[model samples]
Target: EPEVTQTPSHQVTQMGQEVILRCVPISNHLYFYWYRQILGQKVEFLVSFYNNEISEKSEIFDDQFSVERPDGSNFTLKIRSTKLEDSAMYFCASSVGTPKQYFGPGTRLTVT
Candidate 1:
């Protein structure tokens, strides 16, 4: 089965810098999501996108965060400014209008 893939499995950045986390979701999936797990915490939803537009977003997805489907196969999350508190493992998920979601290995972001 095809699975989601993310780039730079581990990323280390300085505080106040910009970072873009990339993902290629399953080809047939119609919905894509960005989630984050802050080390010991549970996975938290940040944003969801469909048809090249945002469908929903959590409060955590502030003005600093943005999502885009730059091309047919690529979906991305951009953090305009990284903060120490934003350090976490960011996951990309996709589903075909179902509760079950396929998640990528995740990009571990470390902000100093």
Candidate 2:
């Protein structure tokens, strides 16, 4: 079975530093998305990408954030600056034009 893969599984950073989270989605999936769940908070959508373009984004995806498909096989999320509130578990998901999305194990970010 195909599955999404994420790297570094865990990250620890300073409040003002930058961080890049990486993921590789299922090979045949068409839509990709990024979401985050702050500790004790609900999972929130951050952005969705398809056809090498952004399809949708939430207010949480501010100027400080960006996503890229640097290689056909890999997707990345970059945060220009980190904050204490940025500590959370970031998930990467993909779907083949369906509401059922397959999610990665998630990368937990811890900012000090």
Candidate 3:
């Protein structure tokens, strides 16, 4: 079975450093998305990229965030200037569209 893979299941970073979270989406999928869940919050969509451009995005994706498909098999999310509020579990998902999406185990980002 195909699955989305995210690296560094746990990340601890300072208050003002850049961090690049990496993910490998399922092969043959047409849509990829980045979502986050704050400790007691619901899963929120950050951004969705397909055909090399953003398809949909949520208010949470601010200027501090950027996403890229650096190569054939890698998808990355970069956060500039981390903040304490940024601590959350970031999930990477890939799907053909709106039916079902496969999510990565998640990278728990902890900022101090």
Cα RMSD of all models vs. native, in order, equals 0.6, 0.6, 0.8
lDDT of candidate 3 over 1-112, digit per residue (tens):
9889999899999999999999999998889999999999999999999988888888889999999998988999999999999999999999877669999999999999
| TM-score of every prediction relative to native | 0.98, 0.98, 0.96
lDDT string, candidate 2, 1-112, tens digits: 9899998799999999999999999999989999999999999999999999999999999999999999889999999999998999999999999999999999999999
- Residue 14 of model 2, lDDT score: 99
Go through the candidates in order and give each one's C-alpha lDDT: 0.97, 0.97, 0.94
Off by more than 4 A, model 3: none
Write down the TM-score for model 2: 0.98
| Candidate 1 lDDT score at position 21 | 97
Better of 1 and 3 by TM-score: 1
Over all chains combined, what TM-score does candidate 3 have?
0.96
Please, what are the lDDT tens digits per residue for candidate 1 over residues 1-112? 9999998899999999999999999999999999999999999999999888999999999999999999899999999999999999999999999989999999999999
User: Which runs in model 2 stand beyond 4 Å of their true positions?
Assistant: none
How far out, in Å, is residue 40 in model 2?
Answer: 1.4
